[model samples]
Target: MAHANTVLINALRRTANKLSSGTSYQWGHMGSCNCGNLAQELTLLSKAEIHEFAMAGRGDWREQVEEFCPASGLPMDLLIAEMLKNGLTTTDLQHLEKLSDRKILAGIPSEIRSKMKYNSREDVILYLSTWANLLEDELLEAAPSLESLLKWEEPIPIPEDILL
Candidate 1:
């Protein structure tokens, strides 16, 4: 699962919104595909730029991910590096392209999740929203309470037995 952060969570929602509002979604298109769209949101790159980077490599997102090497100067590798720097793992990239992340999938309602088609824009939108929600929950859970943040250090009370 992705490490939850506000930026990544917001990006996921924005991607979902873009899809919901009819942003171009074609599973076959390298730039507009599932991972591609998220990459766009994360890296602030256009679809054409993403597509071009992918083309410089030999395979689809899955293959590119499998072969990802941060040290390599290949365009696709560089692009994937940027996505990683934004908090995604290679496994996450693989799952994003296929909507196969079990954690994210589990966040969706069973009825809709079970029927989801990886290539369908509606399904993609739903998946994105669910992922964002999951991340938001994670972010909240990890946040410090106001009392904890404002607390000052206190003296530890030694156990009575140890003091004796």
Candidate 2:
């Protein structure tokens, strides 16, 4: 069991590193190109707008901005809250938490999850990060041998032209 845990942890760490590194580029691309598409129909300004307003205000504008913006559409706050409720954070183990009451507000932002019609990009990232962290712990617990680690089910033979 310890061996299995170690192998799994290493695999998970590799996967998480890959995912996190790729995610920065992916997020940059999405924000640049996709935000316009996502916000096309949204008349409401984002929380960033509210923040800017607060920053620009003479004194104690946070409250006024909070009242003004109120975080209507899809954003991180709603997304994080939902993630917390769903038990998708690092602390969650059984993956049995209830769906957030603000599921609609927690709409997914990524082109991938969007096409899949799931949660927003931020939500998906958080979800995967949480799982990856958990799997890392599991790997540490297992501590599998390298031989057992390397042995996955063999791939079936492919045609010569199709082989990579």
Candidate 3:
């Protein structure tokens, strides 16, 4: 799973919202597909820019992710590196492209999950929104509670000479 963080969660949600508001979407287009929309949100790049970047590679998002080399400096690789730096994992990209992450899939309601088609825009929206919610939950679970904060290690001593 990708690291639980607000950046990834918000980007996922914004991408879903963009799609819901009728952004261009096509499973066959590298710039407008599932991962492409997210790339747009994360990289602040347009669909045309994403498509141009992807053209530097030989395969689709899934294949590129599988073969990613952060040090390679290819435009697509660099774009992918941006996403990873912001909290996404290569596996997350692969699953986003295919809508097949087991945990993300399980997070969706069973009835709706059963009907989700990987390439459908509506299904992609569901997947992204569900992913965002999952990450948000994970982030909340990982945060230190007030009780834990109150119990945090010994406090630093104050100098008596300067005391008020």
Candidate 4:
């Protein structure tokens, strides 16, 4: 599972909500595709801007991620860097674009998983929600225990005169 940072979680949920709410989805459009939508949520760049940036490079999100160079200063690279800083890996981006991450797919019910396709908006929704759930599970596992919380909550002792 990808690291469960707050930014990443918010981006995933926002992307899923946008798509579910009838955001224009076109498989062939670079700006409105699966990864593009998520990129919009993360980078606050419009689809047109994302598409323009993508066109400045070759191939799709997968190729862009594969060829990412932080020093290149390309818009797509910069956008990708932002996503990485928020806890997504290039591998996760590739999988988001292609819907081909075996581990993530494996967690989906076989009936639904078998029907999923990369360019389908519903499939992307399923993928994002499932991935979010996995990340949430990881976050929950790493949460501080009640004992630890109580330890931190214990009031520091002070002389009664301090209250005067």
TM-scores for the candidates: 0.90, 0.22, 0.92, 0.88
Of 3 and 4, the candidate ahead on TM-score is: 3
Highest TM-score scorer: 3
Distance from true location, Cα of 97 in model 4, Å: 1.0
Stretches of candidate 3 exceeding 4 Å from the true structure = 150-156
lDDT score for residue 54 of model 4: 93
- Model 4: how far is 33 from its true place, Å? 0.6
TM-score ranking, best first: 3, 1, 4, 2
Write the residue-wise lDDT of candidate 4 on 1-164 in tens digits. 47897778878988999999999788778889998898889889999999999999978888899999989989889989998888989999888888988877887999999888898999999999888877877787999888887775567898999899
Ranking by lDDT: 3, 1, 4, 2
State, as a TM-score between 0 and 1, how close model 1 is to the true structure.
0.90
Evaluate residue 52 in candidate 2 and report its C-alpha lDDT on the 0 to 100 scale. 44
Q: Name the lDDT of candidate 1.
A: 0.89
lDDT of 2: 0.33
Give the lDDT of residue 142 in candidate 1.
89
Q: What is the lDDT of residue 85 in candidate 4?
A: 87
